[model samples]
Target: MPALRIEGYVIVSADGRLADADNVMPDELKFEGDKRFFTAALDRADLIVHGRNSQEDQPNAPKRNRMILTRKVGATAPDPDNPKAILWNPSGASFEAACAEAGVRSGTVAIIGGPRVFDMFMDRYDTFWLSQAPRVHLPDGEACFPGVPARSPQEILAAHGLKPGQPQLLDPADGVSVTPWRRVA
Candidate 1:
């Protein structure tokens, strides 16, 4: 089998929160440039992986093959609501096995996440695309990673041995930029 390229995508507020206090991604965090970039990347992925609460609500969402991480499943099970989705429990089965059950033998695996889900793939990701809305700050909100509110997201990523690339301005007016952090070989 061809090697799987694992990558992650996330957008955070200046304070490193992924969502508001209510766990909702507010409109303030949404930028058209980031959305377009995210959609294009997901379009190229062979399989998308995320926790049960996270989803990229694109027009092609139903057609995209995805694996939803859930403790409710024993191992891997077909998603009854969506034929292209699979419910997976990592404690019960390996990621490769879950990918196999999802019919994705190879190609890129996109990790779009909630904090716990993003934490799970920290060491595994070949690259993580981090976008920041420098002007926004959601205090007492959901962090992009578990260490946030204590440690910055970059600090946690660097601790995992991933180095950031040059930041690309996604929306200059909105002060939004994206940086690709690659794991050291």
Candidate 2:
């Protein structure tokens, strides 16, 4: 089997929230720079993976190789509405099998997230892009890593042996920054 690189991408608020209290991403929280960054990042990936919620949230997401992690059984086929995406039941099918089903040969696989999805790939990521809006605070919102009890994203990544790189400003006016973390060899 060819080596397949795995990476992660996420955006969180100052209060560590990934979405609003209703489990939806607010339009105001969307930063154009971040979108551009991720769009370009995915361009280099052979496949993109996300949970069902992420798939449903992006109704118009551009056609690209993708895997939608779902618990629904017998969904081992490509999504009819999205030619580039396949509905995968990880419990029923292995990730490698899903990649083969998606036609991904060998290249980076970007993992976009909901907390559940994020936690699932915590130990497998080689690189993770952590973007944040330090000035934005969502008091009643969903955390980046919902179920796993963690103090902060940085601490969590560090504990996983990921070394943080220099931070880049995604949007200067909005206090949005993105930091890349690479796992220690």
Best lDDT among the predictions, by candidate number: 1
By TM-score, the best candidate is: 1
Clashes of each: 0, 0
Worst 10 residues of 2 by lDDT: 55-64
Tens digits of per-residue lDDT for model 1, 31-77? 99999889999999999999988898789788799999999989999
After best superposition, candidate 2 residue 142: deviation in angstroms?
Answer: 1.3
- Can you give the lDDT of residue 22 in candidate 2? 91
Q: Residue 156: error of model 2 in Å?
A: 1.3
TM-score of model 1 relative to the true fold?
0.98
lDDT of 1: 0.94
Taken over the whole model, the C-alpha lDDT of each candidate is: 0.94, 0.82
Off by over 4 Å in 1: none
Give the clashing pairs for model 2: none
Model 2 per-residue lDDT tens digits across residues 16-96: 788888988876678989888887887778888998777423433565688988777574786877787888887888878
